[model samples]
Target: MPDLALDIAFAWATLLLFGGGLLLLRARDAMHRILALDVLVSIVVAQLTILSYSRDVSYYIDAALALALLSFTATLVVARYVTRGRPF
Candidate 1:
């Protein structure tokens, strides 16, 4: 059923989240670290979406939206800073 599928997806997302964290920690360069962080945020967003569906809560989706927007803006700023030595 769909519930079982969602559970599987949630487990995968959790594993990915931990893997992303490891990648972020192991990255030796600024760009690599930035990319890892973005990946982590994306995984978190996916997990949040799964939670929203499974729990039937609207707020989780809203929070996920806000998080995604913030992550995107932050990634843009950080990427600029890493390449240009300044964020603006």
Candidate 2:
């Protein structure tokens, strides 16, 4: 029963990930693109976390953490570049 629930959740997450990618591609403005990219990253992290929980694997959790950090740094850099015309 619990496995079925996890599978359903995973399916929903996958759909959300796909939608986020589409939004990222279709965004008209730099800021909108950045927001969509952030959403995509967040969905990826959520999928990784769900995979870790379903498989009882510690490495997936670690990878998710690393991905989250990288996404945060990237978002900050992009936002700075968009606002100031340069990221330092």
Leading candidate by TM-score: 1
lDDT of 2 by residue, 1-88 (tens): 9899889989999999889888988999999999998898898888898899999999999999999999999999999999999998
Worst 10 residues of 2 by lDDT: 41-50
Residue pairs clashing, model 2 = none
Q: Write the per-residue lDDT of candidate 1 for residues 33-82, one digit (tens) a residue.
A: 98999999999999999999999999999999999999999999999998
Q: CA lDDT, every prediction? A: 0.95, 0.93
Clashes in each model (backbone N, CA, C under 3 Å)? 0, 0
TM-score of each: 0.97, 0.95
- Candidate no. 1 TM-score: 0.97
